[model samples]
Target: MSFRSILHDMKEELGSISRKGFDVKLGHGFRSKSQRVVQDNFVVIDAFKQSCWANMPPELLRDVLMRIETSESTWPPRRNVVACAGVCRSWRETTKEIVKTPELSGKLTFPISVKQPGSRDTLIQCYIKRHRGSQTYYLFLGLSSASYDDGKFLLAAKKCRRPTCTDYIISMNPEYVSKGSSAYIGKLRSNFLGTKFTIYDTQPSNAGAKMTRSRSTRLVGSKQIAPRAPAGNYHVAHIAYELNVLGSRGPRKMQCVMDTIPASAIEPGGLAPTQTEFVNNNVDSFPSISFFRSKSIRVDNCQSEAIPIRKEGMLCLRNKAPRWHEQLQCWCLNFNGRVTVASVKNFQLVASREDGSEHESVILQFGKVGKDVFTMDYQYPISAFQAFAICLSSFDTKIACE
Candidate 1:
């Protein structure tokens, strides 16, 4: 039937159903039919019955009632929300779908749990039942510092600004029973340190974990490369190419190598030209790759893979190697570090000829180089380069003076 016709039929049915006989007394105390209005036992229930006997289908009527229950209202109408649910079996079925089988309160929202003799995880189960189809959701947590005044400002200006998720502070449990490649299987405690409150996933988790949208997904920059994979032979070989010092001296530039080393710059370890040979074999005045032994190759700072090479080579002393001045926010990449008797490339420490042909790149050690006396390359296939670079067994930090 047409919707108008259907609505007309429903409206008629709703009008026909008389709640006049349902004594105003029936809604409250179990008063006899003749009970007076003086007692707290009556409902001018025509309004309630009107709500219950909605001319439309029970499903549609229920949906209407649900919207009303959640929308803005002055006097709490849970009673109204509940009263319509009890009119008849059909009505009961619809309302039962909404009213708390067991009501919920205090720091929680959703389907309620009623107490009974049976054991039930009503609170949790009700939530699970609602979202069982969609199994996973992420949570991001951030701890920040802000003054009380900021909190007031935040409450008012939240619509205009965004929260910064730069740093996080949390106390870690001293002990944990881990699961298969995860900690989710174990219990965790969050009696974390003192901090400020701001907008984020501020939802509290009694179970020690809260999930919310604002505190989830972290943003990353495109220039940010992934962490180092397990140190391998390929990386060792890559560094070997970086250490190859054969930059063209005569200003004839080299070409781009793409992701790999340039074909002309691909001399392997133990195959570099020594200083004497480079000076004698001065075919085109290319800087010697095997010219100097590495006095030291170290990985410093938290980058873990920041290879710094303190070796013997022609440094670009005249024009200072470009450097990044943090305070100035200026980048002088090539003119800051050890000299490149060569040119520079995009995101690289390249030593190239005048035509910008790449010759050599700076390479530092791979694995952990500790403070004490441990070798440069221990855990992988990088022994050859170490031997090739070490001219003197030890530099002058110890017994023999330089």
Candidate 2:
């Protein structure tokens, strides 16, 4: 039998037992109050533990789940694995151990994977759709090339502008993008000039991480309603756009300082941090353990003090210089045909060494694929949250850079 069919049958069997096995009515009219209470409690507890699927042999359960995990390798069909996880606690734990992180499997199976590092060599292809009316952006994992095809949703962000700065509030939920919403994960905020930006994570990026004192709470309205959980904004990366002094319009130049990643991570025998699970957003709970968490750096001074181009041992990325196209009369960087119709926002990023040389492999690239639509592909040393925030910066109006 197919794996899904097997699982469905087991669920039906469990449902049947739950409906019939717990039909014993509460107290008998003849029984004393104390005796009835104890008997009723026992019946409730017993029924809770005896939902039919609990009786399945461990060996059989593992074998069935193993088959399901091995069969579905990509999304849509791959959602079967996710379905298995929700079956019960036993199924959820089993699936957790079976599914690998995006760094190893290159598959984003869980919501947490969006916060973890991607595979070193393979690009996780995704696209963004912009809604001008609502000032929101939706990120989706491209399942097919057809623009009309509904892709798997990944993340969403709503642009909020202020007199001094602009904020791109990002969330996992398409319906809610406010800081008070549990779905709020992270955001990108820019300075008055829109030349410098900071990326903030709702949870600590690593153990012993600290939040900036200035922006520890929700940022809008005269009075703030604290989140239902203990969510802190941790500064993970800083982005800066170089100003054009010649007074000529050209492709935007930018650099990103990845504070959490060490420069050595790009060299041989080096490693980058990779998160394995999502943190609990409940106020009563604490962050979950995954890999070693990186120390959080205070970014309160970033706006007042100038950030250096290259840090001592931190990873830095710069825009890949595009070659002048003689025929088209426009500068271009090859996006492997993923990008078309060039605009000033079109750019690819590569890790740069202290010597000012750039790694040939593009770590992240964003470009227009259609009107109100863009393609964002990234891999290695960065999570989808970081990448999406960086792309959002490209959408900002940079009067200085242009």
Candidate 3:
């Protein structure tokens, strides 16, 4: 059946379900006011449980959802897949299972996909727009030139400057960009000289992830009405720029230690931790993923402290050394024309072998397309969060590295 027909059928079923009569007064014998309210909630829940959509067979539902997912591959149509997930809990679980991780499909179907890694075979092209006046940066999922028209919003970060270091508060919510916001996911912090940087995720990156001493309760709303999981900054990666002793002419050398990912992940049949769900305690409140098209503003200011880096058998990445162009008299690496201008921020990252050799295939590349605009393309074994944090490190002014 066509997508329009499927949508019409779904709407009709939902409308009929909503119109089903339920006698709320049947629970009038409760002793206390709160007890009566709870009983009423149960009744409503029971009514929803009896809905035809909720009672559909798991196998049939899975097949139908899979068909919808396969047919609608791109946006306005892709929204149908998301709509299917929002039908009910059973449908949501089935849809989630059908949708592949971005590491394999290169599609951002859900919000959690941002936390997951990119595709292994193809580079997911994205771009970042920097608002200098506000010190906030927005990350989008496509290479649209006209204000994110052909693009989808992915993540946003607000730069907070301090005396000793800098912190970029990353959040899925574009409107409220802060550590306290429910959308807050991770952050990128720099050291005093801007040479050393740390990437932190609110949720654990791996199964054996250790808890840091800086854990805090995630506030729900502006009034802090409800509390959820502890939104702590778990160390995920570390980035450091080598000081340029020759000075003024050499390219910036950088290295990244992926604490959560092992060096073996780049090998065949290797695995890395993938986050299937979000950090929120209740999944019901986050049933569907929605994209916002507005600019984000800073909501809170939080201080940063030194967190010791602990690395053992972890994956290491370094800049793919650029060749000296005798004709242009400048360093150059092929960005596949994704990059237009030559800037010191332009660099490609590749995994370092155990024997100290770098891989030929570029895993991530960030380069300038225009003033305050840069293209960020990343592939598997590293998430958009990690890649964006690593790119943010390049924005820090490294006087010593220069």
Candidate 4:
């Protein structure tokens, strides 16, 4: 055969092999230009697309998501539910519906911490919603005045390693006001276990600047009592504690007192006692008489037996009474303070009935609201100063004391 005819035959053979999907190598083991171009241009489009959860049937998808969203014990779901909403339109709508439910949307709960602005001053700010129907209450805890020269002072408890055994100081500013006078009002000290702590009346007497051993008031934890279901979503039953006034004489000496009356309990003819009146009545009930007592001497019908103090001076209540609120036309609990903006410690004031029913009307909750801030909600019957002081007591752990 001629050279041209041989070349033509070779070309035909190569073309036949190329059509069979075999890679043809040219000089230097490189693939043929035509074969390379054809391979580059050929795209493999998958007939089976990636599977997605969004394609799931609406009913089945909702069931699967409900398990995750409701898994959290908190009132409003926090993690997976919120994250799933951003993934798709269907997820967003489902999450919105779930969160809008009456139980979840009615209350607000948040975390809070204490911040000290100065060595003698502490500041706290938080938001609180009193009840389903009431407006949000803003709580602020700081110095009444920024001036340092004033001998009178309000302070936050300093962070203590041994909170139970050590005395927490709420010192007066300037250390010394008049000639040879020490600046100290009172100190709060807890039991060895921290289950109970007392605020002492340390203000110096007329004789001289001396620390008085007189106990102003005490708060005792109820860890030994039977646990009830939490009244609100963020709260557990463990936070229950009792407020006790120190007494001198008999079994009824120490009184379990509440400063604020529920708005429901106030009758048209009944008197609504002032916060000062309430405090004075409890304080005067103590055997020791002082000039601070008001001459009027108003009595409140809302006094309970002192929760018996243990051998260690720790008092725990067997039961708590709900306050009546005539305005809201329901039983309510007022967590507000007469002298302080918030309680010195964190506490819960639950509105429960005398019949021991499961229905809770209004829960006045005080707790950590945010970083360096605590929350107080409910009708504030007492002064902000007193409420702030009560909240200060709750900053440390009662169980661990650390």
Summarize candidate 3's per-residue lDDT along 125-154 as a digit string, tens digits: 889999999999999887444433447778
Q: For candidate 1, give the lDDT of residue 168.
A: 19
lDDT, candidates in the order shown: 0.23, 0.77, 0.77, 0.32
TM-score, prediction 2: 0.85
Candidate 1 accuracy as lDDT:
0.23
The 10-residue segment with the lowest total lDDT in model 1: 150-159
By TM-score: ranked, best first: 2, 3, 4, 1
Model 4 lDDT on a 0 to 1 scale = 0.32
Candidate 2: give the clashing pairs. 206-293, 206-294, 207-293
What lDDT does candidate 2 reach at residue 64? 80
Clashes of each: 27, 3, 0, 44
Select the stronger candidate by lDDT from 1 and 2.
2
Cα TM-score per model: 0.18, 0.85, 0.82, 0.29
Task: List, residue by residue over 41-142, the lDDT tens digit for candidate 4.
Answer: 586422111114345578966775666555542423343444455434565566555543212232111110111111111112233222212211223332
Considering TM-score, which of the candidate structures 1 and 2 is the better prediction for this target? Answer: 2
